[model samples]
Target chain A: MVTAKLLGLVFFTCSLEYFSLPHLAHRLFPAWSYLLSAIVLWFIPIPLLIWLPVISVIASSCFFTRRFNGGADSVMFWVGLLLALTYTTADSKTHFSVISVMTIGFVGAFAYFMAGVSKLLSPQWRTGETFQWSLSQTCFSETFPILRQHSRCLSLGILLWQLSFPLALTHRYLAIFYIVSGLVFHIVNARVLGLSRFTLAFSCFYPAILFLSHSGDH
Target chain B: MVIMAIKGLIFNKRTLPLDLLRLFFTSWSFFDRPGDSFRTRLTLYQDATPILEQNWPETVSFKWWQLIFNPAGNDWHYSKQLESCAAILSQKYPSEDFLQSREFKQYLNHILKYVGPKSFDTISVLLEVKKYSANADFQRLVFLTLPTTNKKTFI
Candidate 1:
């Protein structure tokens, strides 16, 4: 089951990147001829249906070019590659064993520590009000601008919640609160601010899966 | 009037430089003696400006680009400028001892609001500047500090 799920994730990611290669290459490669060729290749619908390797070739080329540029582009390319590679090899028993577990653990721990440290350093965050204000401003402001008036109180509430996030690791109730608050936060962001991409990509579905997947085993 | 304008420059601005300065000052304020804060300094300057009018030189001007970028290519120059600006502002408001007061905290908070937020590295630079300079005046310029990270990468 795990192997099938891992393969599914890999295939999905690869297909997405492949399908999006022309758009990605257009942004990376300014040369008109190269762009034209990429577009033509992308539009070759029948071939794409028959063979997946072609998509990989085009995507890899675009990735290499962008990654070599050494800037924001490179960082994005590397992160994308990391995500792709992780998904692709997730089912391989050798790859998924100790290394994968360690990597995920480190990433999870680091993310938690970063959140805690950021809160600790900021006085507003320490006081717990800033979180509430931030949530209202970034999450709830658009759909309900009236909430903007209570930004201070909202920000304080958010701060308190975030400050308590680290506690979730040790306590089940705290963990549940963190997850609930996080889901609410993302839902509000999607519903109010129209930031569906962020909500989908970082907040709601992904983190929930991670939390649930890890909670039982580790 | 010039002193007031200078003080305003230190406080207002929604741009990256102002944000960096706010981070720099806030981090410094954490380790500072309870009395010395950005708010205290600003109020002191506001209250003392009338009296310091004669001493406020008409020729007082800074190389504005220095606030935007460090021409010396050294981060140390940036730190020096921050300290210098704070010192100059403090000197202008000598009467109130703006270096130590609750108003200074307000000033820091106001700057924080305008500057908003920053990532980890920016925070580190602010903390570094604070550690290097014990005086409040020097720390104010910390906002003018720029990110040392290569910008080409999409962080």
Candidate 2:
């Protein structure tokens, strides 16, 4: 169980995300910024790796205008910060692995909670109309296209899934219920709306939450 | 004690939490339908046709390679650019007072460069502050313009 490897994977993924769209960095810095970023994050060690997160946060804030970075980016930054703290510390009671795991759980649950609350705030969500609209809008499977044909049932199912996210914390069975629902929801998100990044970024948190769920009181 | 004091100062007015809610949540409220709610759309039109309508598969693939495979990225970044641009181009922008705003100019310039072809002559931004009442559908479309006083309206 190499903490560095796991954190490295997550950090590497989040950092190199810039390379795919070099135009983002090209706006802030020159063309060499992506190459410099790749070099620093990968080749450099802890003394320098600490700066990667700082640069990432600064770059993200500057690029996204300080208020609009999504929850996945937020999760990555928080974990990066924890990893940075993990680097400098003397390996006391608070280990980097433990803290990163906790951040994932907290952020994952928080994301779901906020999403549920966001859904509740919308009248369209209450009426299940947004689901109907989304179903029709997305380019999904044959089953989903047919699901769009029967809007009422699909809409209700979506409503139940969106609101049921909090049940993960209530009991073991309920937690599994929410977990399965989340998988299905994100699958639909990818298969339908083409939001596959969400599926990968968020799934990182599931194993931790699931382990916590199993260990917690029923 | 310091945490409590800071929390008291920020939460005393209750502005921070609501702002946080807006920052973290997806699109303030997902209620896109006509209502009392606030909705912002970064509608980009090129050659009189909408960008999304044109199908940007070549622009950026809708495939998994562009979506899930790229761990370091997602479409979230693109949407953020639009959201922030719309925020800067709020309805209050058309007023004479905002004409000299350097930040506004920068954002408008960035959005034009990011989305549309550089050779295109005109870039039009339409901000609709819509409020729906039981009696009437209240919608005001503010056509945002460049900082120049040239009187050449793109909209």
Candidate 3:
């Protein structure tokens, strides 16, 4: 229940960020539909059965119209759908089952792993040239002089961290460390790069990370 | 896994069902490639007279509080759409054939509406893309001219 609520709040923030944009509308519906759904998501405590379909329809609208904000939107879609299914299971009234939490954790880990692998395959990223260039394009490049100076080393470190993210499931302390560090990384990206959605979207899965790590402790 | 997801989700021709599935499996390659400069501009023409012009990726100022409700992300997405259309148009297709292609028409329709409530006899969207290498020098200079050119440059 806690995980679902936190995810919902994140979704609400994402939705607001999306619908607030001027003149971007669905092909078949007005932009206000999204605003309305976001209001319902936050103000009204609708049951999972009721809210799941509502959000699914809205998500479908965003997808078909090519308005889905980022990859986090997709992750949230999968998480919400899967959580709805879990809502039908025994003990779901209290909390998600171990399998469900593990599944969510695995999905988050796979996302990070794939990101690292993709960066590894890119020669520009490997050389940190792309990182330097991207930072140079940003408005806040002057704020992180140390980051620019050590771009290659930091890029490689980030690559390794993403690749090893799945190991967080193996131990609680490691999970806590990864989650905390991951939050810091995302927070920095959000503040510097204006990728605030990633901070909220990725954090939605942290609960699963914590849950799985605790389960492994026993 | 990303390749598998793309194969399973995307088809040669897009449809409602395919897009719905694709929504759940968005590509996860964040910053996998070097950042390139691309800009799209729309010029509205009325009976041989260019009236209004608009540039995509409209200017945005980042704020500390915007971390909670940033609209720049959507702006980025729209700019990417313009860039994608520009890429397709750069495939060396004949101007007439490319203009009549379904891809261009769909993009035109969307962009037309996006440009707001304005009626123009014709609209032209130009994409300017600059790709830099390690050396940071210009190469392969090409000039654009209208089909009815007779020693006269469009620019």
TM-score, every prediction: 0.33, 0.61, 0.75
lDDT of 1 by residue, A1-218 (tens): 23222322323332333243331222222222223333332443232231232223233233222221112122222223333344456557665533433343334334434555565576664444454434332211133556555655665565455455555555456556665676676456445433322222222123323443456446
Q: Which candidate tops TM-score?
A: 3
State the fraction of real interface contacts model 3 keeps: 0.38
How many Å off is the CA of B94 in candidate 1? 32
TM-score of chain A of each: 0.45, 0.66, 0.81
lDDT, model 2: 0.48
Work out the iRMS of candidate 1.
Answer: 20.9
The segments of candidate 3 whose C-alpha lies over 4 angstroms from its true place after superposition are A27-64, A91-96, A136-147, B1-14, B42-55, B101-124, B133-155
Residues B1-155 of candidate 2 have per-residue lDDT tens digits of 23433433443344445434443443423323423322233444445554442221122334555344542224333443443455445555765645455444444444544454333333455444333344454344445533322222222
- Candidate 2 vs candidate 3: which has greater TM-score? 3
Model 1 alpha-carbon drift over 4 Å, by segment:
A1-102, A105-109, A124-146, A166-177, A192-194, A204-218, B1-155
Query: Is candidate 1 or 3 superior in DockQ?
Result: 3
Off by over 4 Å in 2: A1-17, A22-51, A62-68, A83-90, A93-100, A132-159, A162-181, B1-61, B69-90, B98-107, B115-155
